[model samples]
Target: MKIGNLIRLVIFGLLLVFLIQPELFAGFFGLFTKNNQPAIYNQGSLLDITLNHLGIVAAATLASTIIAVGLAIVVTRPFGAEFLPLSRSLANIGQTFPPVAVLALAVPMLGFGTAPTLVALFLYGLLPIFENTLTGLTNLPPAVTDAAKGVGMSGWQRLIKVELPLALPVILAGVRLSVVISLATATIGSTVAARTLGEVIIAGLLSSNTAFVLQGGLIVGVLAVLIYDALSALERFLMKRTGQLGRA
Candidate 1:
């Protein structure tokens, strides 16, 4: 494997070890504490919290991807072109408001759990995916699209067989951005009673436990890095495959 890939693998392996047995690193982190107490966050299982955190992010990203991509596709179509401005504005609404504020507003309706977090994340993730999808679909080479139409392909056929395939890489790029941002943002979900890595950080903050804060931050950071690398690899693979198919 290439040196960079090998380094990522090693970092990911160590992240797994840290997540699985965080207590093992207590001694190391304890050195930074004032009293040098054990650097453990025992309020809940790190594994379970990590899993829940990932679940929330995945769910939100999936929902966002579906809705955003659908909107993008619709706006790019001849029949729906007039809706482009409206769609863009709607997608922009999410980032216009702070996620924490959204969470606060949603809590009254959703009653403080995964729902509010999901809503917030879904909204926050929308803009990038939508914009990228729009860019991908709208920026297609006119010649290629014309060729598809010349071959007697219907609009739908041209879209599915020509446009979408060519646009997959760019769409995936947006998805990668959304997912990585969501992964970090999901920690904030804990403030609204969602189970997430933020629980550890919050607990640490409440009791002035540096170890707890560090542990939580470490997990989130490592997880983000791992997922980012994985998604980047996926995007590269898709782009390569799309290129090969185009040549064929």
Candidate 2:
């Protein structure tokens, strides 16, 4: 692994350690187990909580990525240019609005448990993806396209062989950003009973068992790092396959 990758791995481990401090201490100082009832969540297990958050975050991110990419493709096209600003702004607004506020507003209709969070997270994750897609596609060098055109390649051919290949790395970078953000945001799902890592945090807060919160938060943080690292590796693999990154 590169020095940078090693550094990131170390940092992630340190972060996990800090977040789970209460648990580590609970086993020693016994401060955590004192007066703690079996946590309301699955006999004090944080696994259930972490899984729920990850599920919603993953699902919402997938939906957002698909929609964002589609809208990005259309918005970058000439016919879509006139309204591009509006589309971009709407995506931004989605990110800017608080997830909790969105939950409150949406809960009346959505009624709870994953649906509101799914909608809000999808909206929240849109801008980075949509904007990045726009930037990546537009920033392609003119010479690449001119060469394709000069060689009598059709528009579709130019996009597939020239534009998309070159633009994919940047586009995937945006995807990485959205995925990480979605994972962190998934904690908000707990407030609506969406079965996520948030349950750990909330349960800890409610019961005053700091260890529970720490455990959940630590796991969630680790999960986020793992998720992001995997996506980054995938991005690198794609970049290499596309000739955007140098091959080993």
Candidate 3:
């Protein structure tokens, strides 16, 4: 294996160790803090919180992608072109409104737990995915689209087989960004009583435990970097399959 792959494995191994057995690093965590207490997030199992965190992010990203991509497809269609501005404005509203504000507003109606967090994350993730989808669809080569029509393909067939396949790289790019952002942002969900890694950091803040804060931050950071690299590899693979990478 390449050295880079080996390094990635080491990083992933350490992150897994931290998640599954954080106390193993207590001695190391003690070096940073004056207090001799073991640096650990003991309120709940780290693995469970991590799983919950990932699940919430995945669900929110999936929902946002569906809505954003569907809206993009609709507005880009000839019959729906007139709604582009309205669709753009509506999508922008999510990004325009602060996530914290959305949480504050949503919690009143949705009431605590994961519901409000889902709404906040879904809204927070919409703009990038929607904009990327719009860009991908609009920027398709005219000749390529013309060729699809020349082949006697129906509009639906052209979109499904040609346009969507060509646009997928850009769409996945948007999804990647959303997923990474959601991974970090989901930590905030714990404030509203949702199970997440943020709970570890928040608990540390409330009790002045630097160890808790560092561990929580480290876990989330590591997860983001690993996921980003993995997605980048996937994107490159897709590009390669589509002959987009070799041309350049």
* Cα lDDT tens digits for candidate 3, 1-248: 99987999999998888888888987888775655655677788989999999999999999999999999999999999999999888888878887788888999899999999999899989988999999989988898999999999998999999998888888888989999999999899998999989999998888888888998898899999999889888888887887678753
Cα distance off (Å), candidate 1, residue 27: 1.6
- Each candidate's TM vs. the true structure? 0.95, 0.82, 0.96
State how far residue 174 of model 3 sits from its true place (Å).
0.6
Among all windows of 10 consecutive residues in model 2, the one with the lowest summed lDDT is: 38-47
Each model's backbone clash number: 0, 3, 0
Which one wins on TM-score? 3
> Which pairs, if any, clash in model 3?
none
Ranking by lDDT: 1, 3, 2
Q: Summarize candidate 1's per-residue lDDT along 1-248 as a digit string, tens digits.
A: 89999999899888788779887877788865666555788888888899999999999999999999999999888899999999999999889998999999999999988999999999999999999999889888788998998899998899899999988888998998999899899999999899999999999889888888888998898888888889888877887887733542
Runs of candidate 2 with Cα error greater than 4 angstroms are 1-31, 36-45, 246-248
Task: Single out the weakest 10-residue window by summed lDDT for candidate 1.
Answer: 239-248
Error of 3 at 161 (Å): 0.4
lDDT of 2: 0.75
Minimum summed lDDT over a 10-residue window in model 3 is located at 31-40
